[model samples]
Target: MKIAIFGPSRRVGVVVDNDVVDINGAYAKYVADTTDTARSTAAAALEVPADLNSFIEQGAGALAGAKAALAHLSANSITTGLDGERLVFALDSVRLHAPIDGKSRVFAALANFADHMQAAADNTASGSDKATLSRLVSGGPKYFIKDPRVVSADGDDLQFPRRTDLLDYEAEVAVVLGKRGKDIAADDFGSYIYGYTLVNDWSIRDNVSFGPDFQYSKNFDGSATVGPWIVVDEGLDPQDIDVEARVNGEVRQSGNTKSMIHSFAALGEYLSRDSTLFPGDLISGGTPKGTAVDSSIRDSEGGFEDDSAFLNPGDVVEISSRAIGSVTNTVTGTRTGKK
Candidate 1:
């Protein structure tokens, strides 16, 4: 089942075709219409959390309850109306937020795709160190922590940081953890995963080459654009899904998850070797080979010049996949100053 946080209140909703079933709202209605003793029983049987983060943290029991509630609603003919605005609202009517806002530790893989690594290699100067590239090619997935505050929802505007001229977009697939585990093994990866979501790992290219730290280049406010909704991992295969990205309706990045240098299980094992991965922690699989910086608009010094390839203030970036839906964000004017 696809789950989402919708509307101004950010309530938990289940995406059903072209509409969303208000799972939390339905449970609340059940409690309101039942007797004192029956209300307690109903609440326990249909325990849908108020938000997506809390829902995920509740583990398997919460998911089961939510599915039960959805089944109950469907059986009773309580689905949305013809206009898709009754108990279930039209998918476009309500606002959608990042599935795990302020509730997840965001970690993203760097150059996990062989083609992306080749692109980065081609763009770098001959005098540059190849040690990091060599390590990524042979070693496990290279990752960096991103601030959750940078996460923005679908349809939200991405703020162009004034500090940099080369803003780029990376379309990636994000793994959402359901259970907590330390030193998790590769074979047991499925037991710990909850679902998958779309992630636009926005980057500032200027800050990247100057130093080794990725936080400065990637963690600016509204840098991580995530979610139309999260598709549960029950029947979905993250290893072989199609991933694509478009800027202002023009196709920019086109690739598949099968091209990943490191598998999802390998990334999970590497991440959990010495630390615990809790529910709601997001692990973004690296993007494919078609970023704006990979275009042929580079300057003579191999840096991106102010050109058509780099993201501008009015550009609209839409990142999509076959499993998880699209996450579209428009670029807005930047605030001038260090953020």
Candidate 2:
């Protein structure tokens, strides 16, 4: 029951390859060819599962119904032209967009990992006063909200800002919210999730500090690199997966989700309380240890200063998770005022 949205930009069409069904096409075909009623969201096209947001709008029932329909199709050996074709397009061919576009708000955790915080501390000249994941909860849930414009899909190039020489990568697994819920109970957190994906939170080391507004550092354009795809049916516990960050095929970061201070369910429930969460909202649960920023593999001998080694043009970044798959992107730099 792995579903995907394909096409250019916001005009993506839905596809369920296993069933040879096109949710977008089926909706149109049914409205014109059958007696089925059109749905405001893509959920009504149960014969074909649509986007993750559609799952959010329809809830758990939509998933069950779509599976039943897909089962019926699989048994009959249904074949659509898009079956194997679209899947091939997904592999290194088409540029993947954020699985769900225009998500209202992105909830990001800060210092959610003791090792990550320690790495952050190591990178900067600051003393060890920096909090780690295990000790972060001594206060409240340390979190941040990312500007939606900063979000970009996989296979796209991120522009390295020339103003700052330090560009770092934080590998994390992000959850896609499936349903709208406020004050969600911990027991019912699973029902609110659609699936998971890998996130590479690109950062500007200099801009990030205890300033009046920390959002400026994390919310730059293309700072949010998500997708490759969302696993709609792969019943995975986000906190149980392993995450890795590699640069030019060299593993720079490696850690397991078991080290997360707050579990995925807890973060979701905490954010939803007293606040409304809509379909397509992204919740990134932070990264683990061995991040590139904390490693000593930079080309400091040459003019490539240690800070300049953060991320330069022509560098490739690969972020992967055991369950959500991998997403790789190339980095390119541009002078700020240059036309």
Candidate 3:
């Protein structure tokens, strides 16, 4: 099901497929109303459950109950419609919001590709041991956090900031955690997952290496563009999917999840062991080889030039993975108005 959380900040209403029904608020009320008297953790918390988290937290039984109620409702054709065909939105109608808002921690892996390592090695063959090394060659998934404030929806406009002119797009497959787990094993890892989503790890590569840390280049106002939908299905493997990025109709980057140095299950089990992963936390599986930003084949600029189609105002960036849906976002005017 394609679940959507919409409406103004305070007046926001959770709807399923543009329905007027308040699945979001109803799910919350279910927990608040039934937590004390609810007999089964999975007992029906409300007429319909808004998200997987609510159902899981309420317990397996509550989730089953909610599903049953939804099924019954479907059988009877009793439901509310939120003007599915003609709904008006305050933001750009095409603009997308983070599928799940306020994702507390965004753990991203840097250069988790052997190709990236080779490219980085060639770029610094002088052996000048400067800081800021690519983690793909040195260690496990290099984790980073994306500020929640910067998260945007799949089709929303990515605002370029005034700080830098160098902007690059990373095509990646991101995993959406459905449940909390600690020290989870790779073999038993599927249970903790909710589903998959597409994430474009957009960044400013030039200033990224200049700063004392990557946070500056990586965490701009609108860097993390994620999601069109959250898929909930079984028997799906993350490591065997095709990941690609397209700019304005041309394919800029293309690779497979199989190239990832670390698999999704491995990273999940590894990250969860000491720290708990809650529902809605995003773990980006990392970009693949062929990133124009990191390539040895430099454009005429001597430095990585924007000609590799560094995003300009009105450019469309699309990230797609077979396992998850494709997310197409447009680059609007830079936050600095320099572009």
Candidate 4:
């Protein structure tokens, strides 16, 4: 089942066919009708919460309740709830929010795909002995934590940073953890997996931060663009998702997670060793080859020395997959970063 937070109020919803069922409203009504009237509100909040993060934290009980709520709605033709809360809504009538609110940390894999690293190096490296993704991966998995403050949702306008002219995009699959686990064993990812969302790792190529971490280069107002919703990991093979990145209508990056240098289990084990991994904590698999700064595209189209062209003010960057769904966002706000 697909789970989402929708509309201006940010209520938790379940995607069924072409409509979104308000989970809280449906579950509350179920509680009131099935058990006791006094237990309705509290029961719905605890069993199938209004926040996606809270819902995940509730674990299997919440999952069962959410499914039961959907079943309850399907059994009847309910339109509105006891307090005039909407039971079901047209999908297009509401706005999609990030699967999790801005409370969870987003950990992203860096240089996990050899082709992506090759593209970055091919554009800038001039030395005879240049660094490669393979060389960078002789040790282990590398990752960077995104600033949760800048977590933008699908269809939201990207806040173009006012500091750099070279804006780039990295398309990836972000995994949402199901439960809290510290020092997760590499082979034990079967139970910890929860769901997946698409992420576009927007970067300002010119902004330099100390060391390899893109601390300053990545922490803009809209760098971590995620969601339409999260697809539960029931049928997906996390290590084998096919992802594609496009600018407007043109393909910029295309690769499968099978190309990843480090396995998902290994990355999970490493990430959890230092700190506890919780439900709703997003771990983004690294992007594939072909960013805006790709050398081949730059050489083919002679608009700039670095690449074809940096992200303009009105370009649409779309990151999509067959299983997880798509995230489409327009480059909006100021172009002061280009100035």
Candidate number of the best lDDT: 4
TM-score of 3: 0.76
lDDT of 1 by residue, 1-339 (tens): 888988888878888888887776655544443445545434643466767777887777777766766666777676542224355789888887898867579888877888876776676554343455566677667888888866898999888887887789999998899888899999999788899998999998774653476578888888888898889845888788788999989998988878888878888999999999988889998999889766534444655543457788888899998778899999989634322
lDDT of 4: 0.80
> Lowest summed lDDT over 10 consecutive residues: which window, candidate 4?
295-304
Which pairs clash in model 2?
A: 56-178, 113-133, 114-133
For each predicted model, how many residue pairs clash, with residues at least 3 apart or on different chains? Answer: 0, 3, 11, 0
Candidate number that wins on TM-score, 1 or 2: 1
In angstroms, the error of model 3 at 83 is 15
Put down candidate 2 lDDT per residue, 1-339, tens digits, no spaces.
Answer: 444445553323333432224444333333333345545234345433455465456655655655554454446554332223321233334444676666557788887887866664554443323333225545656788877656777788888876666678889988888777899987888888887777888876553454457777777888888776767767777768888999888888888878988877888888988999988888988888765555522232222224533666788999997676787889887534322
Return whichever of 1 and 3 wins on TM-score.
1
lDDT of 4 at 90: 97
Tens-place lDDT per residue, model 4, 1-339, is: 788989878888889888998888888988887785687988798888888888888877877888887777678877787698778999988898888767788988877888876775665543421444346656888888888776888889886677876788889998889899999998897578888889988987663443765577878887898888988736888888999988988998889988998877888999999789888888888888887755432222223464445787788999999888899989876766343
- Residue-level error in angstroms, candidate 2, position 311: 0.9
Q: Please, what are the lDDT tens digits per residue for candidate 3 over residues 42-119? A: 332343444444533444444344444344444545443222322223333333456665635678876677765566
lDDT for every model? Answer: 0.78, 0.66, 0.62, 0.80
- Candidates' TM-scores? 0.88, 0.79, 0.76, 0.91
Q: Which of 2 and 4 is ahead in TM-score?
A: 4
**Looking at model 3, which ten-residue stretch has the lowest summed lDDT?**
80-89
lDDT of 4 at 124: 55
